[model samples]
Target: MKAGKLAALGAALLIGAAPAWAEAPSAAPGAARIADTATDEARLMALFRDDARREDALDPLALIYRGTAPDPAALRRLFTDSQLRAQRGSVIQSLALLRRIDRRRLGAERQISYDVFLAAKREEAEWLRPDSIALTAVRPFNHFGGLHIEFPSLMAKDGAVKYEDSADYRTNLALIRAFPTVLDNAVARFRQGLASGVVESRLTTANMIAQIDALLAQSPEQSPFYSPVREFSAGIAASEQPALRAAYGAAIRDEVLPAYRRLRAFLNDEYLPAAREQVGIAAMKGGPGLYRRYAGRQTTLPVEPEVIHQLGLAEVARIQTGMDQVKRELGYGGTLKSFFDVIRTDPRYHPKTREELARGFAEAARQVDALVPQYFSRLPKTRLAIEPYPAYREKFEAGGSYNQGAPDGSRPGVFFYNTFDLPSRFLTGITTLYLHEGAPGHHFQISLAQEDASLPDFQRFGGNNAYVEGWALYAETLGYPMGFYKDPLQHWGTLDDEMLRAMRLVVDTGLHAKGWSREQAIDYMLANSGMGKSDATAEVERYIAWPGQALSYKIGALTIQRLRKKAETALGPRFDIRAFHDQVLGSGALPLPILEAKIDRWIAARKAG
Candidate 1:
């Protein structure tokens, strides 16, 4: 992995020049002039390799969000356009980054390094996953044909607007070119798993099929995707010449539909037959090991499964104790579970309309954003937009999500509230949710990281799942101190929200690792956390589908909390929350250990100062 190589190079550079950067603000008296010019070509080659690795990592996201088409003609045209841009960009970026390395200085390793670079480049060029997957599994998901509309107009109003620019199209084309090769390997893996009687959930396959059918059922002209195209074509008659419209229409009707139909056929004829009814990553090849790798990657620590399991157990216990205290304070409950029932049945918590519910969240987020500047001095320059979840994807999205803005300042960060089901958008724990998902959490951390140019691309753009989610969870805990839980009910609501994360630790580990059935996990959550049955069921299913990812929230939050306490104690009255936060966020999203090390360094520096 280029991970170790990158770290080694960074360390080597640091060791060679730490004195230069770390010297006092005033010049060191009589310091010998250091004009060291020893450059490591080996290190440069490693950086080249790491840059390729970075591209490989980002390719999947580009493919997933580009657009959807229902038929072969449209799909092929999209392939010709969107996917092609992504692939070409990946190869060009890889080659360009590789070229930046000084090859001649590598001595004997020069040819081998060049060969490795070429091999990696070829591999990227040869990847067919984006196209193949779209042609197979993904095609079924792209129900929107040429109706090409981007909706929720909430984004456009909030200044998070982005139009299809030539650059966007260029990037899309790059992915198309690389899509085929990636898909080939993926299909081979899928087939091998099928041969061994190991496959994905039957439910996942069914969902894909159902989504595809919905798309196909829509008239070609009525598709959400086509409307935008139509509007665009009509609006700029000169630009949307006859040839372009015909080509667009032809692509939608021909290439896209056939791709969807082919995928539908495979799901029905082959893949679905071998699919398992169960929903957990545990059943996959190297299941436990793979999860551990994910855990390590997400948390940026070498946390063992057993340790996490124990941590989950402890969190569940601690939160349940807090809930008991809250119950007594409220003075109207039988058991804690019954209080949860009361909250669920309570009318005051539920909003009457989707718009009302969405406005509630947006207002709460705005309130929090207002308070954030007091605590954080190093805030991101980028803007934030609040929007309702897109309608077509609401069924798949859990309550809310935060999609990062573009890196080049063209787009603002987005926080989407899924208000499809109004009753589901109750005030219960809403304030805490806002804090965790928006201000002082994801918005603060992710935005700051993206804005930091001093950090390497990987640190700024890449992330440790644990640190990001964990920090957010920690932010929720910070609400009370910030005077957010002024309402007693909101205070109880905050505790309830924390209890949910605690429950995730147990339920997620239960379903995937501990042989707990889906129903069992759902019941445990519903009874313990007082969540609605629908919410509880969906949460359990998400855990089953995505494994160890749920564990990162509590685990990551705990590490940050621990570090903060350590810093506070070390600096005493001199410790500034703003400075401490700047130190934490300015470095970007690093692994927990790296984060801790950075924090420790910051603390010691404060002490010395």
Candidate 2:
């Protein structure tokens, strides 16, 4: 669900420049115990600020997202071997610096900041370890992930990259000119992957090959990288417009196109055929351990694959029961298997046109938007825009996804509803889908977090996937409290979406850990849920391409729900839904353990009061 192209890769939203001293004046942590208390405190904060700046400076994409111009060379580069080594060394140095900070002397909020900082640095250092860094930093892309998908998206007028002025055009043109270098870096990384015997699945490689083939089929004027040149604002001089356009167009033809052509040849002739046929990562060398690392990073929890698999199975059963009851209410006397077949074939449950699909999402958003004030005290200033995936990218996109808006609320957050192969899309899932991806789901959690200047930049722009995705998953249930889902079908939509998440737990672990085949995973989804074969196949492939990520949704939602129940049980009448929500949204995203601790303290504070 946390999908982005190149921009997504820059999601290392660090603890931004330390909270202003004037805002939260407190004694330096552990300062009293040290000979130079004040000096230690100043050193700690200065380190935090310096590290954040270093990362931003190195990341051209992050700077672009922050609405600032970066060195044009940033567009041409991602990671060189030397830069990667330097970055690793920096993380190691930062970790050492962090360890010297005294936690006991910090104020209440600063203590939380310290803990968050420690966990982030520790995680960074762990990933930087020779074994971990080599495995991950190489193979910088799957068929779905690499800059191949992102570069095109970012260059569009609507994307994160800006092109308002002549200088902006030149900056982008510089990036385009440097794209050959970017592709070379990717090829070098892929070669390292090939050498290490750490290649992606053939499925992933084949799809990547096809992506390049599709793009290469386009005309130079129509190239993804050439999109920005087509739209010239008044900021660009009329005489200079044609020249900039031709330059970018030729860059795509001479520079960008050939880079992908080489990539296509390498993948088609070498990598794909040499890649492992097995869908699971466990079959690769040192795969079992590597898979665990992925799982840990995605979930931020130490729970094993088997534990998640079992939890998924239980949740799947619970959701199935709900589905059966709803089926019974609808007076369908058939078994659940028959029900699945019925919905799949039933035209009424399928949208006839893409416009209808978009309209349905619009209505769902309107209903949720109207009821927003009743459920929470704070709402996002950023508006939510519903749109379909662009034609070129639609085939590969899942049913729908949400992208974060700009922090200042100028650009609206988008819920991209996939309209490809409309017959394969389900109408029953719309209400729940909107709740999960639109108004109260990603749009709220991400927008509110980014908009809040009170939180550090790291908390706003980056955090754990579980908290973000889990909050979205939990938002699906809010449809019930908001007085939607009254229709039996809409109620079933919620169950279907819940079942989708539950199935992910089983299928993700099953594919990666239990050695389940692609066919077997798709079949299981079809049997257990309302998914069409096409949708199920795409979802399974997503898990195969990106391992361990699928497990976060249900695991995260369940944790949040359990904590909410605990708070509700203890607070009774004192539990203000508004305040509890504000607290959760107020701090942005947190690791699960940190989130649990924060909630426990809140409960204790409420009890004391």
Candidate 3:
């Protein structure tokens, strides 16, 4: 879901490769160049804030998401090769500046910042490699997590962009007008992929083409892009609304829809024919190495695909035992596979209507909110809102996803649940899904960091998957102490959700690493858990479109669980669950190793006290 790109001459600074800049020069023992720990730390923090501002300047959408006003001029920047080079250069320079700080001289808090910033820059450096860019930048968008899908949602009335005043509407109109250029640049990138034999999978290509077709089928008035002008904010004069409406309608009709048609035509005519039949990145020119980098980046460790695949298989077997226990408690006489079938097809286990589904999640949130303080000491100030995926995007979306709100709490963080194919949606996963995507999961972790002004900008707003998603997955386990899974069916639901993550470990690796077909991945999912066919298909396709991301959930949960167990054992009677949680989340999302080290320090401090 996250995206970023560098040059061949700078290959020495690639991830895992040591760059010369990292070794801060040692001052002579007799020299007067003493380390100013406070001054250095202040300088470092200032640099972090400055660089974050620079990053926000380049990415107006980021500013919009962060609740900061954006410059209209920056909004027109297209997705071009020159832009990619500039981003890479900025990262390389930032990393150089970061390494100049003597990390050991700083206090513990800044040291954590120093390490996290350095690691993120290194990861960015690797991703920007010319070869990596060729494989990735060339395929700028896909069916899932692509800008084509995300932009519309972001521009919606209830979405991230502000709609308070005439200028706000004008800024949004500029964004809408600039979209065609972005889409055209994507076509250009796809052509580059085709010429270089780094094309996307045929399956994803078809899905993307279908998505574009769906957008083109709608009139400008019905389009999500035009929704903003349908009603102007109270701040806008009534007389001004007509001109804004006409401008929006004309932009969508003349520019946006035609651009979608051009993209769709190119995919149908040129790109689809040239797309790789194999879904895994391994089939492409530099796919294997790219997958390895993705695996490392997603997991935040240099773990091999086979190792992750084996871990997934072991987890699937273990979670199946839990599912069997739930089945026995339910007094089901059938085998686990049959039980899965029953859950999949039974109307009682599925939602009857979209409103019913919404109510289910709403009730789940209400229950979890009451119980949150018992487990977590600090909560997110930003309110959480539950909504269904817009009609345009639900088909390609996962069952649920979290979109963070403004750090200042202007916009409420949204947990979007897919209501497409309502009959196929399960009620059992509601509580578990809410726990992961809402409170004590993403909302808690993201909001807490951004709200704390004490941390550097990178630490507050930036994060890796293993920590962010891992924390959410681990949060799902808290349902036990909170007592929401008392029902036999709900217990099975949590296990099934856990099984989904476990299956991702298997299915993702199987698809990308072991030459498993899409059908094979979907079949593997169906045989293991109670996921419906349609949901299973979507999950498999998600992994295909974005490799190694699924692997993060289980891997991250395991790391956090292991650390908790270690803390419990070491501190014995002194162990405080709330305090342990505070320690885990207090520093924001970290690489797995950095997180472990942070926890170890906390345990040591507890023992000494």
Question: C-alpha displacement of 32 in model 3, angstroms?
Answer: 18
**Between the candidate structures 2 and 3, which one is better when assessed by TM-score?**
3
lDDT per residue for candidate 2 within 249-354, as digits (tens), equals 7888888888888888888898888799998989877788888878877877765788778878888988999999998887799999899888889899899999
Query: What TM value does model 1 have?
Result: 0.75
Question: Candidate 1's residue-wise lDDT over 128-173, tens digit each?
Answer: 3343233223222211211111221211222223325433323333
Candidate 3 lDDT, tens digit per residue, 1-609? Answer: 001000111123224643443232343221123234347787577668757866887787777777655775566565687777667756765765665577777899888888788777777776777766888889887898888878888887877889999988987888888888888888998998888888999999999988888888888898988888887788999999999999999999899889888999999999999999999878878888888888888888777798778878888999999999999988887899999999988899999999898999989988998988888899889999999988888998889999998888889999999998976789999989999999889989999998988988878888888889999999999998899888887888899999999899899889888899999999999999999888999999999999999988988888888889889999999998999999999998988888877888999998999
Give the clash count for each candidate.
61, 0, 2
Report every candidate's CA lDDT: 0.59, 0.79, 0.83
Give the root-mean-square deviation of each candidate in angstroms. Answer: 10.2, 6.2, 5.1
Q: For this target, which candidate reaches the highest TM-score against the unseen true structure?
A: 3
Give, for candidate 1, the lowest lDDT window spanning 10 residues: 12-21
Model 3: residue 288 alpha-carbon error in angstroms = 1.1
Q: TM-score for model 3?
A: 0.94
